[model samples]
Target: MKRIESEQNASIKQWKKLYTRKERDKLGQYIIEGPHLIEEAMNHNVQIAHLIIEESYQMPHDWEQLRLDPWVVSKKIMGILSDTEHPQGVLAICRMSSKELQVKAGGKYLLVDGVQDPGNLGTIIRTADAAGLDGIVLGEGTVDVYNSKVLRSTQGSLFHLPVVKGNLQDWIAACRQEQVPVFVSALKGAESLHDVQSSGTFALVVGNEGSGVRMEIMESADQLVYIPMFGNAESLNVAVAAGIMLYELQKNRK
Candidate 1:
């Protein structure tokens, strides 16, 4: 296997480029740092461009033989490329696959509207994947999915779901094209989340943690739903809200 000891190596520069959204978009590639995420990506047959491993990580006795032929690199180089202070020593660059955004009429989907935090975005994606939602629609102003922290938080769920992204109005137009009902979540006066009655497919819109859904989108929603909070706190985290809502939506799905 090749070794990337020099920080100045061309490949190192390319691997480092995965840190920025522009570079990730330009190349359609993302970096996974933790060993578990890397293994999941490999096992799922995601397209891996390259992998970097630190010699000090000491190959596992059982895994050394079957894992991909990884390039060994110095710890300093890992520090330079990894976003985390404590680098996982094993990082892999993988390509992003295309996802379908449009849903069939009355189909199920989760719309992440204007979410900005990478960690929240990642957790939401992981939760949505686990809930068996058809896919995720990341509306405008959402965090970059390829952000190192977000990708790490997803724990490789990014590979499992169909994640489509666009502006609020544009996604709404696309949903209309598919005849899917849009359910927006709001803090006040909205019906309880479980009260919504739907015919076929539906898209749940969970907005930013601070602002909630935009006024325009809320107006367009077929129905607005609110989660009842028993505690003094106003509401739940976006990811937590997503989990509750998804469970409510798919409680009886086969």
Candidate 2:
């Protein structure tokens, strides 16, 4: 094991760059803090490049059996590497998966379009995982899936499922070619979500919090659906709506 006490250490500097999306994309790596996320990555077989722990933090004995060599750093250095206000004292640098996700026949997926909020995107991902969806395709204008806040919000579900970036138009086309129904959520001129029978195989498209799905994309959907609002409030949050829709679609699936 190596020890890093200085904040100016070269490795520390490089890992700190992971806080930015550009650096994560350029290096094809991202950082996940907290022991739960790290353990989740290990459990899911996500490639972990490095394990970092603050010198004062006590690691569980089981972690010692892992193949990874831990690097002990001072709390000060960990603070620089941590994204959270309260540092968990543990973090891992992980390599991005290289596997390409294809939209296959009879598979379920969530097509996210222009969702700018990190928390919402993360929740959507976690919900999709719980719903037993095959994968998530992030459409253009969506926030970077590797964003720290987004990663934290996923609570390690990011490691449980495949999340890839792609063009919604092409994905929609591919789903249709495979005979998978494409359902886009919309505020107007749409079928109530309750009325549509769950096909067990589908691609549900959700969109920006403010504007909702793009008009052109909505027009391209095999069906447009909306949740019936019984409350006095205007509408559901994107993530909440997605959870409701995904569960509805998945409950009847074999």
Candidate 3:
């Protein structure tokens, strides 16, 4: 195991760059903080580029059994590497999956359109995973899935399935070509959510927090569906609405 005490250390400097999306994309790597996320990544067979631990942390015996060789850093340096208020004393640098998933016919999919809030995007991704969807396609303007808050909100579900950054319009075209009905969430000129029947395979398109799905994307959707609002609430949170729709579509499969 190596020890890195100085914040000026070259390795430390490179690790810190992972905090930015641009750097993460350029390097094709991201940091997963804490034990649970690390474990989830391990279970998913994610490649660990490197492991960083607080110098004072007593390395867990079970962790030692793994193939990882950790680099110990001072707590002060850990704070610099961590985005969280409280550093968990453990973080892993992991390579992003190089494999891009092609949208397949007869598979369930969630298409995220322009959802800017990290928490909402994370929850939606997690919900999609829970619903047994094949994968999620993140369209233009969606929050960066690798952002710390978004990653935390996902609770490691991102590693469980194929989550691809993509163009929604192109995906819509692909879905149409594959005969995978694409449903968009819209208020006006949309069918009631309860009324649409799913063929056990389709793509659901959800959009921005305030504006909802873009008009161009909506026009391309095989259909537009809306959740009925009963109370004085203006509308459901995008995450909540996504959860409702995802499961409802799953039920249609049954």
- Specify the poorest-scoring 10-residue window by lDDT in model 1: 59-68
* Full-model lDDT, candidate 2: 0.91
The best candidate in terms of lDDT: 2
Order the numbered candidates by lDDT, best leading. Answer: 2, 3, 1
How big is the RMSD of model 1? 2.6
Give the backbone clash total of model 3: 0
The worst-scoring run of ten residues by lDDT in candidate 2 lies at: 245-254
lDDT string, candidate 2, 187-222, tens digits: 889998778887699999999999999999998998
Q: What is the C-alpha lDDT profile of model 1 across 1-254, one tens digit per residue? A: 67877889999998887788999999999888887887777677788888778878765554466656778888898888888988888888888876556666667788888988888999999998887777888888899888888888898898787887777777777787888778788987699866766654678899998998989889888788888877898888888898888777665243
- Model 3 agreement with the true structure over 1-254: per-residue lDDT tens digits: 98987889999999898889999999999999998998898888899999999988877777789867999998999999998999999999999886577777898899999999999999998999999989899999998888888999999999999999999889888888888899999999998888888888889999999999999999998889999888888799999999999888767653
Clashing pairs in 2: none
lDDT for 249 in candidate 1 is 63
What lDDT does each candidate get?
0.82, 0.91, 0.90
Error of 1 at 27 (Å): 2.4
TM-score of 2: 0.96
lDDT of model 3, residue 23: 96
